[model samples]
Target: MQKINVLGALLVLGLMVQCKGDKKSVNKVESNAPITEVTESVVDTTPIIIEKPENIKVPDGMVWIPGGEFIQGAVPQDKMAMDHEKPAHKVKVDGFFMDVTEVTNAQFAKFVKETGYVTVAERAIDWEEMKTQVPEGTPKPHDSILQPGSLTFKKTKTSVPNLYDFSQWWNWTIGANWKQPNGPGSTIKGKDNEPVVQVAYEDALAYCEWAGRRLPTEAEWERAARGNKSESIYFWGDDDSILSQKANTWEGEFPVTNNKADGYEQRAKVKSYPPNDFGLYDMAGNVWEWTSDWYNTNYYNELGAVNGPVVNPQGASTPYNPNMPYAKEKVMRGGSFLCNASYCASYRISSRMASSLDSSLEHLGFRTVATVDMLTAN
Candidate 1:
């Protein structure tokens, strides 16, 4: 058993508090903080944009985003769009290829077998690690590290109006991972075809490296989701009412009652629904895809030229300012199947969310991307 330290417990408590607030106001921050300098120079002169090669054929079920400038934010009418998506800007992305579907359990299983990999959730916490988390004299909290790491949605006895109090639905469960998605009793035996859940950012990174792919940057993900179309509320178009047919989202009352109208109570199979114009499946709703960028609500404000010099925008290396204490969380894009209009309306193309780097959940998964060079080779 590992004891829960006061500091660590307090940190977790604070995160719960922060997550329950109005996302827009909770993420907003002042601009006075000096940006940390990085070694990489911002490319002022837009590198000569290369067109998608004529002979380039992505693997069996992938698409080539013939990357170019696209309006990358929400329109005024979409009350569903979060404030972080404001100040739409034009972003140019180099040509790249992205997976058409999220990584399925079958795909991840292959990677694990080949590498003999163990996910972060499977590792046990040593005394040193436990010491860092538990307060002095506190009894161990039942060996958290040894326990499988994942968030399980717990149905509440009473209907609660506060949708933001995710604690009502989210529980840190033991024995939950890509294999045992729902905790101890669950198994992925027959679900090898479904997208693997309970994967952290690091876990996704390892898979990408093994496959010679990389996580898509925030800008690249936005452009790919749009599929050369102007930014709209939904990936297919501006309509929020088109969810059931276009994507799998929570169809009924969130937390307590899920109508399962989309043919799934939890996550559905990848490509179980239709694909967008780019032939990308499950981009709007399925599992939230991980991005390489660190989250910052005001990242768009620094876009374009500033101070009379060509201002090159860079993603945050750490967490966004307002949420700095929760810096361990990484950015996740493309809302999951659990997302709904009534609770989390983040299923739109440009919407964003995040989770702890070590946190895993059934609603989270990832897609891979290849750079121009890698795409050319393929």
Candidate 2:
């Protein structure tokens, strides 16, 4: 067995990457008016009406976000917002389409049957790759040998913590993958509707390629999540309180005891809850969606005062916050069923998180995205 640092491989790729075409165009607007005040009673007889296109139906179980500019990041007043979400900036995204729900067990199984695609957890690790990740002089013990790894929840109180330590609910169990999600003895015999878990970043990429789509970049994901709303904390607004009827998140004493108020103690069906303003479901909770950007805490600080960054195809190479651990993990957006008010509140649309490249967890899943081509006059 060999040890290879996944971050090193990514850094190598980042160096050779070429600048791609700019996705957002810069525009300037001018207005001239004299300051004046009018009383509410001054209005005579005027009617206001708005219209929208009727043919804007997104693919079934999906939503079309007419991309534009929005303030991205945290508000100065939010005490709970992480520092990474600071220095709010404006971001403009082109029109694109996104999944209304995360990829479910049934969908993943179909892909497997059609392409015989084995998840990273199911495949044996290559010795050469392993050697590149692990540091020299580290003992290559038999227990540490490459094997299938995925997230698992310990139902027992003694085995799991009641707090936000992910290590409590997530474990790298050997022989755990899509088929054997709970280690060797478990099987996906009846969980066809559940979101597919135990998938690595590469596994997701493979699925995207097979489906003729790609993972959404962090910016694109955020835009889709915001819908047509202004710069707000959540996809809906600045509210942080959990609405029992809206999402599928934890609703009791953390890991020790779940009240199941949301009608679920574990993963729920993808479309179990109400959809967002754009008719997208499970965007706030259920499972975190993967993004193409690397995790960086201060990336927003570089964006302009309007909260928009320069139109660049790729994200920063280094993590934004130097005080934090070196970011070897890719970004995961949208929270999961495990997210609760007490722990891991990241299920919000703007919340961000990351995981090791080779790591897999039952609580993590992903959705697909594609560019929306506008019909042009020939």
Candidate 3:
């Protein structure tokens, strides 16, 4: 009976955008602030840092994350910790090169140009392939609803009365691809430096293949996002109040009002906020980055029983969410701009989120990592 996909369920955190209801309308931003310049490109177009250590070559736009042992989950007393992020367990990760920032429009543009990759959002939906994902007997979506497009957040005309009913804000916009993030009229020009959104897991993987990189495993992402620290509620520190302009999260009321106190209504340019100790930008906000891990709510609990740190822990072999056990979902790290304390506070360093691999949205993007083997192979 639901018109929206699982994306609508995952995004219904507090006052965050929800599925579009009968009240269809778009709220416009009235701000007249000048668009800020894009930050320096993460890709080092010049060949310079070749004299580094054997294990840490520091790829052009990437940084050397000297991986080591660290706690991978959340501890009790961290009131905000979710069930999936509990039972803090020790994990050991190998060193690798990580993109310093989320893959920007310019970077993905090059990949598209080189390989002519058609993103999942650009391809028409296949009902035969999709019906298997839903419970048997669920009605098939109308042919018109199967068009190529992606989910997008539209501000509510009024304050959201029910956070659980997200249909007031989330809309499956037709023609909403990465090239046109907002909808048919939106374009990526002038925002070339911003993180590319509306990317499904396959789209991100295609870009990785073209660039000779791979998506980071969930362990590597958490370890790197923590900046090699032992424990902290957030990437920056334990403090929750420090998430204002430091990260591009919602600063005002939920779907109704976005104060744009951080100088952004939607996604912001990479490096708009200060990097963590690891020198990684946008680790906390801007857009949710995809990870190469299957989603399993019980995965952490399984690791907790281990006697020692789980070395280079790959996620569960199969995806499983009790709420939607049949759906093929992948782990997503780092919260997006839509995250706010008023609704969803997933910006916590230890928080976790997952979405169907086929789902794409305006608030989602990804970065890639390269291991020693991958780098040498290239």
Candidate 4:
């Protein structure tokens, strides 16, 4: 217990915090619309590609996406777009089988070496399910900050003061799970293709129920991160000028200068870069995935008030974040390596966020999807 302090303020008052558990006491949180970046230069078009499902059968590491319609939310010409990714609505998704990356660390260490399992950051927090997400009594946090850890990102020597003060770089390390990402002696050995960072969303739904597959519906992860490049803003179309050859972001002043310059300063391996026109790969930046929906900052204004195309939305049944509204979020989608276009560019594709299904970080990771009756029931 007790390790969480690289100074993300005491790593969020400690307990390797921000596993979102907090509500009932918020004073004024009613802010959503000012996130508009639109630097105005993107007009490439010509993508409409959608291919895969030609003879069907696709399985192996997985790829097939293909379904149709797009416009999920706010990449209307992304300068960064956000306000819960806005009324850039009209959705629809049905052609499945995804995973061509971001589920590595040797496939979650082979589903924890055949299901011995134990992950929500290596277990141990239940303050009676975290004192019903803090407010009423909220007292129980002392066994040196209640054991088992996860958050881990700590790297700043100059620029902090804001980026919403994510403890200036998140720490809660303890043993920083997913094979010691930066805690303990730190290893993931030869990296084993990176992507399995700390994992929680019920440990990516117990590794998508031991690998049959699930967790993609945020309209199937914005239609496989928009492979058809809908109106394009990147899914290999809107020219971020090949953004570091196609995403692994945070190249400069994020938590005081990443300077990894895309050679990787955190979470890279999953395809290392280059795959979007539907082949999939890291899907945006390197981490921050997990979908099967929920986090509703007004669920895209109720799916942009549904005039049509909202099929397969499975998202806003609950969980809202007027900042916190007491915790329980989900919908995560790409954008990690701390993302930066001067802060949270979220590697573009309608970038959304809101994590906390008992959050886990290091960068966050997920990637799974399937159909054909979930691979014909395995």
Candidate 5:
């Protein structure tokens, strides 16, 4: 069955990345250097002390993630883990500072007010790039339809014919930028602390640049997500019963009804739930956050083969998905409000999702991290 690919850019051309325009700027950097192998050293069984380097003031609202070796992908207890998150491997990342929560609308608004910046969803479609994602000779869309828009989730009243038909629940909402999350008439006036949504990868990059931060590599993100408890399916451990009380996620039937059993029908304010072991809120839910890694299903298969632990590993050089072979996809970690066991049970710590680099959706947002060297250099 042919599906309309409005939310996601359709049939991308030859994985041809680095498209032009503000709505579609991507830097697909590759590291040709060999993977640095972790070597055995004298074990310091003493509890590692967490302290910021002298003279380095910690960024406001960020916390230090003490770096250490941890399993990077799926742990054996994660029954919900998918193929992309499999073949759990050990990895070591350097200490870095991470935002305490998913970036909030108020925080993003501050960036916009200071820089007068416009997000990608607030810009009109670039047909030249759009055409590349669509089939050859596909007629250009009407000018009226080319206005700026993003995918906004509109819950279905009844069960969808099938879960694959995403159009059953998502609307192509013009004017649905981060400010108007549910499109026009839906303002963020009173919801400043909710996560800013409808932001594309480029939009997040712009924010990161303004903040003197960058999206964390997928490895770093996982490390933070695991926090001090690195071996469990969740930061809390293997039990799923307490999930509803611990995180903001879909608590009832998906795409139809949300029980709001967690007292939140949608995204709760930042810090609405308890923080993880690392003091990071919304690590398992609230929203799916953008990471610097390119999406590749077999990435773990490659990493799991390496000897010892992979040290401060960067992501795959290019995006790959046998299903959507051409879309320039990036990794989105953590689940969102709409994730559930009935469908997208990605709330597991090791869960992952992927989206086209050029696509923006209401449930998609990002947080950023800064390394010590980055702060000293800047």
Candidate 6:
């Protein structure tokens, strides 16, 4: 109920205070090969060959992205460009399959029912683990504050809090999860088709594993979101003045008011808006999706230019948030219903966001990708 303090030393501790969240790492798999010393003549020359993985049939309710070269990142001098989206670079991605829409509530429910999986929000907080995150002597938050729950967006009236203070509108409500998106006493009974909200990165990964898929990388997501128009600022076209039901972004004052011009104040059913050129739906708004790559504010600068595009470029190997060095955050794309031109205009295709891996909020969710191996059935 109180506005979250942006300058607090325990800011990372309040990461779940949002319609958005972030992490400090993406947990890359590391291979440790044993070192073996060989005699001068022990090594014989042998041909080493690598084979391209075979592509498999596209899954149901998904679309194929016939990958090719595309300009990645925001164009130079973009009016809405953020510092992180600068130094647009060329990236080449291989063809892959992407979900036609975000994972729906019904779809997630099926996964939970079949696998008996529990989301991060459904689990109780570990004070022991959390204690290490705070200053040594910081008092433990109340038991009720530590109860199992997710962050939910609560509308504000009259004046808005400091623009940077997200806790003004984002409440860490106990008992909020995928099943009950708005916290206790809320339900998704009649909203089977709506994109599932309040899912953390791990929960999304679990569903991806059960569905035999994986989360898309940052490049893959940006490539898909851009569709056929590489130069357009938005997924629909160049014009940012008119949204026109193409996405489900906030229509009026952000956090405080929504005109509902898009016909929904909060989340809308997947496919309720128009699909991008690749037959993909909701690439711009509705929910900020998770990506596999780690985030770095200066990642684009790291990718120096080359004659050819950087092939299938994954993001930075390790997450580096100068703000929260300890929290593991991943790349988030496509903004959410809370985005508004008057305030948060993160709906731009090139706009970037990061969130803690454990964040589960009402405006955050994800879709999956079918890698060549997963699609090929191994």
Q: Assess each prediction's global lDDT (C-alpha) against the native.
A: 0.70, 0.62, 0.76, 0.70, 0.77, 0.75
> How many residue pairs collide in each prediction?
6, 19, 7, 1, 1, 12
Which run of 10 residues does model 6 get worst, by summed lDDT? Answer: 33-42
**lDDT of candidate 2 over 258-299, digit per residue (tens):** 788889877888788877777788888887778887665445
Off by over 4 Å in 2: 1-61, 143-145, 155-165, 238-242, 304-309, 318-327, 373-378
Candidate 1: residue 369 lDDT (0-100): 88
Model 4 regions more than 4 Å off: 1-11, 14-60, 69-90, 93-97, 106-171, 174-179, 185-195, 198-217, 222-296, 302-304, 310-320, 324-353, 356-363, 367-378
Q: 1-378 in candidate 6: lDDT tens per residue?
A: 111211121433554333233221222111331111112211223321122334355679988887777888886546767657767877767777899999999999999999998888887677777665555676777776667777788888866745656667777677888999988999999999999998888889999889988999999999889988888888888777668568899987777778899899889999999898999998988999999987775566655434446677667766766555556679999999999875657888898888877777898899998866565666
Lowest lDDT sum, 10 consecutive residues, model 5, at 21-30
Question: In model 5, which regions exceed 4 Å deviation?
Answer: 1-51
In angstroms, the error of model 3 at 323 is 1.5
Alpha carbon lDDT of residue 318, candidate 1? 53
Worst 10 residues of 1 by lDDT: 1-10
145-211 per-residue lDDT for model 3 (tens digits): 6677778888987877777465567887778889999989999999988999988888888898888
lDDT per residue for candidate 4 within 1-378, as digits (tens), equals 211212221344543333232221221224562222211212223333355545557878887887677778766567567566777877655577788887888889988999888787777665665656555654565777667777788778986655554665777766678889778888899989888887778888878988777888887788888876678877888777668878888787777767776788778777778787778887888788888777766566656665666655567666766655556678788788778876667888887777667777788888888876566555
TM-score of each: 0.87, 0.76, 0.85, 0.33, 0.87, 0.85
* Residue 363 C-alpha lDDT in model 6: 87
* Two-way TM-score contest, 1 vs 6, winner: 1
State the TM-score for model 3.
Answer: 0.85
